[model samples]
Target: MKTRAVRMYGEMDLRLEEFELPEIKDDEILVKVISDSICMSTYKLAKQGKKHKRAPQDIDVNPIITGHECSGVIVQVGEKWKDKYKVGDKWALQPALNYQGKLDSPGYSYRFCGGDATYCIMPHEVMELDALLPYDGEAFYQASLGEPMSCVIGGYHANYHTNKQNYNHAMGTKKDGNILIMGGCGPMGLGAVSYGIRFENKPKRIVVTDVDDAKLERAASVISPEFAASKGVELIYFNSSKENAEEELLALTDGHGYDDVFVYVPFKPVAEMGDRLLAFDGCMNFFAGPTDNQFKSEINLYNAHYTSTHILGTTGGNNDDLLEALQLAAKGEINPSVMVTHVGGLDAVADTTCNLPGIPGGKKLCYTQFDMPLTAIDDFEELGKKDELFAKLDESCKAHNGLWNPEAEKILFAHFNVEI
Candidate 1:
């Protein structure tokens, strides 16, 4: 079949072109893409190119696609996968395809596969590992959001603290303890906040801190302090740009310290601040992936040793995490839709990804079949004055108080002449 995709040749080099996909082998499955959400990691990979660990090393001869967060429908099934996945079934892909420790992933490793493309082929490894998941949700974007949500869940699972009694250790977040999320206004941080507040282990309280009050306000509105309070979970948003922000947070915890801290940004000053604020037996998760190969920051190793405060970092989620994210979304425990802030089409992915860092918002969702440019929900009202399509989209989103929902997605796809 003739397919079109955005391929990455090198850093600052991405091209959207048409190519023919070879017939799939018996172990492969052909999928038609639905929705793809642009992740900040894709921006880092696009800029870093060959320097990225998960990205393929070869360039001029063998370029790869450039999107990991995506959703699709099974259009053709191989003989081997026929019983497991049939045509017309919705599916999601977990990008962390650790094939014998080889640094190969769908978007970064395969030329005929990527979330930003019109179509993608699920190769043998993806099927065998059960990474190509069957999705039962009505909203296709939920599948795309699954990958990132899984990363958040994995961070919480990977966190651990030493047991003072046995001098052994305990993994996962402190059960029924206080939790702090640094820079929690961002998309990923917001997911952590939502997941943390309703974690099965049940935290006693959660405080999300950020530098900008406006972002915090928006975060509060999205997550809703009132909702958290109604659920009997204390969710507080604090502006930490002030000089006394640390003191205020310490005071909130009665000067003891937070039980768990999830740091979303890797800035040296902020990272060091996160380090110093760790309590005895506290687990600090440096969740953000660093671009610099030699990234360094000061850590109080003396306190780390004496207080048993340990620091850990994670790159991405495994298959189990991805499944958990989907399961949670299915059960109404977590809403992946809370992360989306902007919607666009395939053509806008290149620009949207290149300017992702400068752009401030949550997840940017792209519909592969549409021809629209990148449009933020905040700008939908303004754009409605010119484009009637956006006018309807503006009203649809406004009906839900400016949030992405299944109805809005249906309106967009129908207006764009794509089957929902």
Candidate 2:
């Protein structure tokens, strides 16, 4: 089969080319990728190439495909796994294969098996580790977003509280306790905020801090304070760039501090601020990853020993977290669409991945079968003046409170005469 994908040749060297894929083995499956959400980790991989720990060293010779967070329909099922999986089944990728204790993963180490392609092969190890998840969501984009949402869910699950009577640790955030999410307004941070308010063990209050007022306002417009209040949780947004930011943030909790604090930015000050805001026995999760190898932050050791404050970090989600995210999204309990602000085609993947940080907005979702530039949903109206397709899409999104939805995706595909 012939597949077109973005392949990384070296550091910042990605090419969008067409190649013939070898016939799938009996133990492997073939899929037609529909949607893929760009991730920061993929940007890091493009920057580091062979130097990335999870990336193969021989990318210069045999280039590897460049994407991971993806979802699609199964086109062909291998005979070895026909009983467990069949053609036309929708699947989301977990990507953390953890196969045989190696750093290798789908997007970074595979040649014919990655998300940024019209078609790709799913190796046997993907099913062996249960990394290829079955998805029944209404939209393919939601399934693609499940991977990032799982990371947010994993951060919450990784937090622990201690029992004074015993040495064991109680998993998960403190139920009905005060929670703080620092630097919360980006894509992943927004997912964390949504999960914080909607999770079964909802927090008493959630305080989100960010430097940008526009972003904070946009976040509130979607996941409003009223919405959180309906769920028996108080939601507040604070600007963290002020001179008295720390003092003002602490006052929001009535001086009791936060029981669960999440740092969504890798800046040292943000990490240190999260440390100071921890209540007695409070758990802090450093959710954002830093690109620098020598990144460091100061922690109050006295508080750690005397106040029972501690911190931990998580990079990816496990099978359980992925399943939870998918179920919640499918049930309409959580809206992963809030994280997607832009959409494009496979032709836009390389440029979008390379300049992801420079671009403003949340997730950039790519549809694999067409050729379109990366376009923001917020700009639909302006683009609509020139094209009627975008006009219909803009009207559809505006009807749904300006957020991307299944109807908008259908309109986009229908305009192109695509059957998806």
Candidate 3:
């Protein structure tokens, strides 16, 4: 079978290419990808073209597939996986496959068998050992959310603060605690907001700050009324670009300080703000993975010590976290689809990643099947007409209770095959 995937070979270069699938082994299974969400890691690799430390060397040398957060249905199950995962069963494919020495597991260690492809082969090591969520739900978003929710769960389990550097597992459960999520408008930050709000019956206040007001408003709408009312969680939006943003955060917490702060932005300024806003004994969770060599923040060490503030960072989640994330999504506790503001086919992924980060909106999802059907015009008059078309679409989105329309979808879809 031929599958579509984004291949990276050089800096700021990505191409949607098709590759031949290998025959499944007795201990493996073939899955047809249903939905996959674009992650920050994907964006980094697509633009930077740097070899990820965790990625296998072979993947770096060869053209590698770029998606990790995805969900699919089992189409062909080999003999060994027949009893465990039958054909026609929907499952969340774990991205991290630990192929110690054997053929690389799909969607795991090798960057080649990613979710961007139409079909991916999973070896027994990944099939039997990694997390698999049986999708008995109505939507595919639940399965797709497994990748991220699992990371949050792992972060929860990895102990935010400890006397011994690597031996503690103290999950945050303090009552009346407040969490400040920097860059809360992004998908990861929004997930943190959902987790901080919905986990347990504990009443917690979540304040999400971002530079873009539009993105902040979108996040606010998702957590409105029902989730906020039931969880006793208030989702407050703040503009971090403002001069007195830190002061604003202090005022919101009544000068006591935030109990936990999740830094979702990778820039240095955001990190500094997180360090400054933390209360005594508070834990600052660095959710964004900064560049490998980029030590972007200058922390106030004196304050960090005197106040006993804890700072921690985490990567992808383990198997347990992935399962829990799927379960939560299954229960409709978190709507992963709500984060999807834009959707296009495989060809649109490269341009979407390049431009969407600068756009003020939600996540952009790439569907591997459909090819966008739109024509491009170069005349100035035609360009003016195109601008009008987009304006009308934006108006329609706002008018229809905040839903994306067909025209906006077309515009986003058209940019996929643009010359890079």
Candidate 4:
């Protein structure tokens, strides 16, 4: 049997290739991938190539399939696993292979295969453990959102402010505390906003900041309206690129700063801004992961000491967090659909990851399979058209001034073919 996969050939180069599927062991099951969301971490590694710590260190380096967030139906269960997972059961797979007591999992530490393919083999331990959640969603994209949402839950449960003596504090379940979502236009950042507004009882004010006006507008249209007027949950947008970003944030908080600040961008400058905007007794959760060996920051120690500010970093999710994220997504408490700004099949992913990050707003989602075959195309051709296309898109975005609409999807999809 043949499978399609996105292979990382070198720095800034990933190609979709066809490969032969491995025979499944009796203790394993074969899953036909339904949908996959491109992870920011995966995009970073693909761009960095050899510099990535998680990249396999072996001869078989080229053609390494690259995807992590994925959901699929159990198509072929092995003999011993027949009773454990039925052939038609829909489920999501957590790419972390370390759940079986190994130091690392297949997708992360080695070239064990990933979800950007037509089919994958799940080990017994992965099927029974890790972040796999049963799926009953209306679309495959919703199911695939589990991984990103799970990571958010992990950050939420990291107990960021609860550990330090002076800085230890909680945002509580009430809506009185102020929460700032840094880089609020990205996928994880947007997810944090949804969680804060919907589950945290509509915080006093849910402030979202991003350099891109389009993304900030997108967040307001989709997330802000969910809160009731009485909750006093206001969605405010700030351009982090401005010289007065800190001053603006302080003004929003009545000069006190935000109670909880979630840092969703890995850029060093963004991190510093988060630390500066943190309110006294505030907890700054570094929700995004920096690249390997790329630490860059200069914080004010005096301010931290006097204000009792806290900083914390977290990555990957535990099983419990995944469960909560899945439940929240299942109930529509969190809307993953609003954040999906781009969608395509396997062939479009390499280009999607290469350019999506540079785009001004919204999460670019890649569909593993599509109802119709997308014409095969090259990345260079797509990149060549980006300048012209981006201009038109930007104009439309400015005219609406960040309104949420399905038209953005049409614009993005029109630029890329969606076949493998």
Alpha-carbon lDDT, every model = 0.86, 0.92, 0.66, 0.67
Q: What would the TM-scores of all predictions be?
A: 0.97, 0.99, 0.81, 0.81
Write one digit per residue (lDDT tens) for candidate 1, span 1-420.
977788889887888788888999999999999889998888998889888877777864688878888888988999998888989899888988878878688887887788988887888999988989889987888889999999999998899877767866777899877788998888899899878877776677889988888889888888898888876788899998998988988888888788898989878877888888888888899987778878889999998879988898987899889999998988878878779899998898888888899988899999887667888899989989999878888898888757787888888877878763
The candidate with the higher lDDT, 1 or 3, is: 1
Candidate 1 TM-score versus the reference: 0.97
**lDDT (0-100) at residue 258 of candidate 3?**
80
Winner of 1 and 4 under lDDT: 1
| Model 1: worst 10 consecutive residues (lDDT sum) | 52-61
Error of 2 at 362 (Å): 0.4
Clashes of each: 0, 0, 1, 1
Q: Pick the candidate with the highest TM-score.
A: 2
Looking at model 3, report the run of 10 residues with the lowest lDDT sum: 372-381
* Order of quality (TM-score): 2, 1, 3, 4
TM-score of 3: 0.81
Cα lDDT of model 2 by residue, 270-374, tens digit = 999999999999999999988888899999999999999999998999989999999999898988988989999999999999999899999999999888999
Better of 1 and 2 by TM-score: 2
Cα RMSD for candidates in order: 1.3, 0.9, 6.1, 6.0
List candidate 1 segments past 4 Å from native.
Answer: none
